[model samples]
Target: MSTTWSAPGRVTLIGDHTDYNAGLSLPFGLDRRTSVTVRRADEPILRVRSDSPGAGPVSVPARVLELPEPPAVDGWAAYPIGMAWALAQAVPGAIGPFEATVTSDVPVGIGVSSSAALEMAVGTALAELFGLDLGPAELAAAGQRAENVAVGAPTGILDQTAVMFARRDHGVLIDFADLARRAVPLGLAAAGLGVLIIDSGTRHEHGTGGYGQRRAECAEATSVLGLTSLRELGVDDLDRVRPRLAPNVFRRVRHVVTENARTARVTELLDAGRAAEIGDLLTASHASMRDDFENSVPAIDAAVAAAVDAGALGARLFGGGFGGACLALVPTDRAEQLAAAITAGVVAGGHPDPVIRLAAAADGPRREPDPG
Candidate 1:
């Protein structure tokens, strides 16, 4: 018998790179998702097939007790394999051999957490097949463990929790300090605002690049400031501690502290239905990431400029930086024009033409009960 499940991808409305620092972030699941279909068998072999953009197919033994001491494989199949491995770790010996097919409309490597969407999709299938009884938070944690331990990506809980907990027409305000999530209302369409996601088309791999390094710098700043995390500092406190930190560490801490406040403001404004007022906050966020965090590339800046010039109310570089995508708050009427201008500008600036995706807030991970 086969069980099918799907999980949506995420877009960070505000708050960038603050998750690992145990700070605040606001994200929403977008309309795109990855779907997985799984069938359990008696054999010891596990097979994974996928149409996930760049991943090929793979097969491995479903041996929970004999998992490789080190993570052995990390291709397209790593996501599902890690899903089964997560189930194995959570409930010993309950994992069974399974065959699964994965497909996604979520663009890979665009900072949309395509990997997390894939993991949660497969994890939900495994949960149903084995009767694991995982809750929303448990499911998110399990997927994060799989991504971190098995996939070797040092990401925090933002992407996984956003995909699992976000809801329709809302942004999930996540406090990573304790994994608490609250779905805040976002009246974008009612307010005549549109979310524009412009893919910079520059590929970034979090594990091998500067993402981990930036995370480490934040930790260093926390150590020097005698705080457990950068979350402890507010925007006012940035000046008090600025002299004590090194230039780079101070900049990193500044970004996190300010971004956390921006998240709170965005949540407040979103709840109040003041969607247009949050545009400057979005642009400020991009500047912090660009100037303070030093993660934005030329293509990212170009996208933001073109988006704003084409009548976007506010545009910022989105994702974990080093080249991913940009988010713009635009008039619903100007969305197509914004897309066209951004594309032309990027290509004219000698960068690859960017693909623009218009997204609305979507519900979190969902599973269908087995009919058999």
Candidate 2:
């Protein structure tokens, strides 16, 4: 029998580093996604293949049911392998002989959670293949476990959750503290606007050193301030603790505190149908990420500035932005213009031409592709 499953990519409209700190995040699913096809096998072996260029197939014995001490490869296969390890942990005898063909339109290394999409796709496929009664949240958590523990990446739950539960034409407002979520309506089209993701195509490794360093730094700051996580700190708390932190930790904490507030404000604007105000928040969030969080690279900053100059409502480097993508909120009528501007700017900044596309707010993981 043929089993086909897909998982959507994610964009964090606001609240970046706060997820692991137990703060709220607002993210939306993108039209871009990764799909996986699988079938049961007679032998007790797990095999995976990717259609993407330079990626090859891999096979592992089912009898070897544990995660690699350190993952065997640093690329696409790590996701599926991590998922299998996670499933084996959750459900004894759940991972068995199977073969999977993976394919995705979600651009890799673009800070769009392409890796999570792949992991979720595989996790869902295995769940279906084995008749496991996994709920959306459970599936997301499983995928996240694979990333965080198995793959050793310190990522928050936002990417997996957004891919699993976001609804079309809306953003998911996630209370990271409680895992409570509400799909906030966005009227971009109704307001004659579009969301543009400009892929810088610069791949950075979240698992390779940088991500772990940042996580450790954030954790150290929280510990020093006597808070449970960075999320517990408010503006006043930041002011009170600012003098004690190193200059860099102070900046990082500043971004997290202010970014959390910005997410709440953006949610309000979305609920009130004030589409025009979104750009301002987007720009502010980008500035905070760039200056305070120290995430933005020169290429990312250039793309954001170019999009705004080309009449985007607001633009910012999105995701874990050392190198990845930038997003722009533009009038739908001017989407092409904004996209072109961002593309040209990236090229002018000595990078390759960026991939530009219009992304609608899309639903999270579903059994069937969204109707229309």
Candidate 3:
């Protein structure tokens, strides 16, 4: 039997990089999605193909899927292969010899968690095809393992969990401390507000790059603070901890501490249906990322300023730092005008014109009806 599964990409509104610190984060699944179709194979091999441009097909031996190490495959194929490997470890049997095809509308390289979307899609399809009864949380954990172990990116569970537990018309408040999630009412549509994303087109990989460096720095901060995780340090404790850390390390700690607090405040605003008021908090979060966390790029920073100039209530750089996309909260009626203004402003600043789109909160991953 053949089956299809799909997962949505996610956008973090606040609390970037706080996931590994065991702090809080606010994220929502976007309308964009990645899908996978899987069917049993006659041969004992897993064959994977992608509709992405320039991506070639890959084949892996099903026998090696149970191994602890990731397969030798690289590029986009690693994500699916990693998922299979991860699922094999999680489930109590050998993984499938199946043929799978992948396609996505989720923009790549713009910090929308496209990788997580792909991973979840693959995981869901494999689970169903193999008759493995896995819950959403279990699937999310498998996806995280796929990224962290098989894919070699030291990422937190936020991306996987965000895309799995997200609810339509709501934002998810994830406490990395306990892996607890609460749905916050975004009410964006009810409030006449919408989310606008501007893709900076600058790409970043989570695998052993500056992303790893930041994670290492956070670990160092945790060690210096004598805490298990940075979540143990609240804003009140910052003054005492500041004297113990170096300048840069202290800034990183400060970002996590303040960001956790900001996430809580945003949650309160969202709970009260005050989505519009959370705009300032979004801008503040961007400032913290730019000045404290040191993750914002010049193009993203310029685009954010332009978005505000174009009447966005608040704007901030989205995803892990270095390069990605910027998000703005704007009036729904003015979305087109704001997008045009932000694009024009970015281009005028000598940066490549960004791709802008309006997105709404969307449901999480699930089995999809056959497109046929």
lDDT tens digits, residue span 313-357, model 2: 888877766789888888888788778878887788887888888
Error of 3 at 244 (Å): 1.1
Worst 10 residues of 1 by lDDT: 63-72
lDDT against the true structure, each candidate: 0.86, 0.83, 0.90
> Could you tell me which 10 consecutive residues in candidate 3 have the lowest summed lDDT?
87-96
Error of 1 at 208 (Å): 1.0
TM-score of each: 0.96, 0.95, 0.98
Instruction: Write one digit per residue (lDDT tens) for candidate 1, span 1-372.
Output: 799899999999998899999899999998998888899867888888887456666777666425644246767676678868877877777778888988789988889889889988988888888888788788888788888888888889899899988799999999988878898999998999889999988988887779988998999998988998888888899889999989999999999989999989989998898998998899999999999999999998999988877778898877788988989999888788889988998888889989897899998878755545
For every candidate in turn, the CA RMSD to the true structure comes to: 1.8, 2.5, 1.0
Off by over 4 Å in 3: none
- Give the lDDT of residue 44 in candidate 3: 91
* Candidate 3 lDDT over residue span 53-169, tens digit each: 998899989886777787877888888988898898887574769999998999888899999999999988888888898998999999999888877888888999999998999
lDDT of 3 at 73: 77
Ordered from best to worst lDDT, the candidate numbers read 3, 1, 2
> Of the candidates shown, which would achieve the greatest lDDT relative to the real structure?
3
Clashes of 3: 0
Count of clashes, each model: 0, 2, 0
